[model samples]
Target: MSVKRPNPAQWLWYAVGGKLPDRYREWVLHDATAPTWLVRHVIRRLVFMAPILAALYLVLAVMMNFDLTIVLVGLGLGVYAGMYYSLIFSTHSVDSRVTRHGYPDQYASQVRKALKQAERDRYNATWRNGGATSR
Candidate 1:
């Protein structure tokens, strides 16, 4: 048995939390300790789920004849629920993974703090540079 590897375009989908490879997960948990990392983590989950939400809307409203307004409301609620779950679960997963890799549990909080500080510094730098920041 063999697992098919995702091509370049599909890599983004995996990065969004579709069973991230252990190597990548380790790298993220260990090396990427910046506030933007958390932001990107949340973005990845949201982006990964967008297509699922769109398909749900199409199925409910177009194929199943549900009202469009109801479908929209349903998707909105679903997204909110997903956001709540993803943030908590994703963080916990990273923390556990780091601990499994031999780091102490407290290291997880340290990583988060470093990420927050990095984000704050970036914001301040952008502000100092005339409020123009490139990606």
Candidate 2:
């Protein structure tokens, strides 16, 4: 089934770590526990950063009359710091989001763990056992 997703504004609010309405609850659960959830989460974070970074650049360059080089350097440092901190709390943040959506705590983790078990089993079969297996 095609998943019901939020509108652009709702998505942006979600990206900004704001809570979305109940109508988009299923979409939020799927987003927090999809097969590529981690990558998707990282992408959402980058999406959240882009606009903020642009605004920061604008404020520094225009409001403060700073040089382009200084603004760029500051933006670069900010991006690095933002990503480092965001990633450090990636799982915690995602889990918290799931709970906020009315799911039990660590629900995303449990779902992802079950989803990954098949892959782990295949890896163990292919390499851990032997390169060649009886069919």
Cα TM-score per model: 0.57, 0.81
Candidate 1 lDDT over 4-83, as tens digits, reads 44455655745554444554544545433544656766776778788899899889999999988989998999989998
Please report, in order, the local distance difference test score of every candidate based on alpha carbons: 0.68, 0.87
lDDT (10s digit) by residue, model 2, range 34-135: 887778788888898999898997798989899999899989988889888988998888999989989999998888888789789889888888668657
Error of 2 at 47 (Å): 3.2
Q: Which stretches of candidate 1 lie over 4 Å from their true place?
A: 1-10, 16-32, 96-108, 114-135
Provide the RMSD of all predictions against the true structure, rounded to 1 decimal. 8.4, 2.8
Q: State in Å the error of residue 24, model 1.
A: 5.7
lDDT of 1 at 48: 79
Scored by lDDT, model 2 comes in at 0.87
Name the best candidate (by lDDT): 2
Best by TM-score: 2
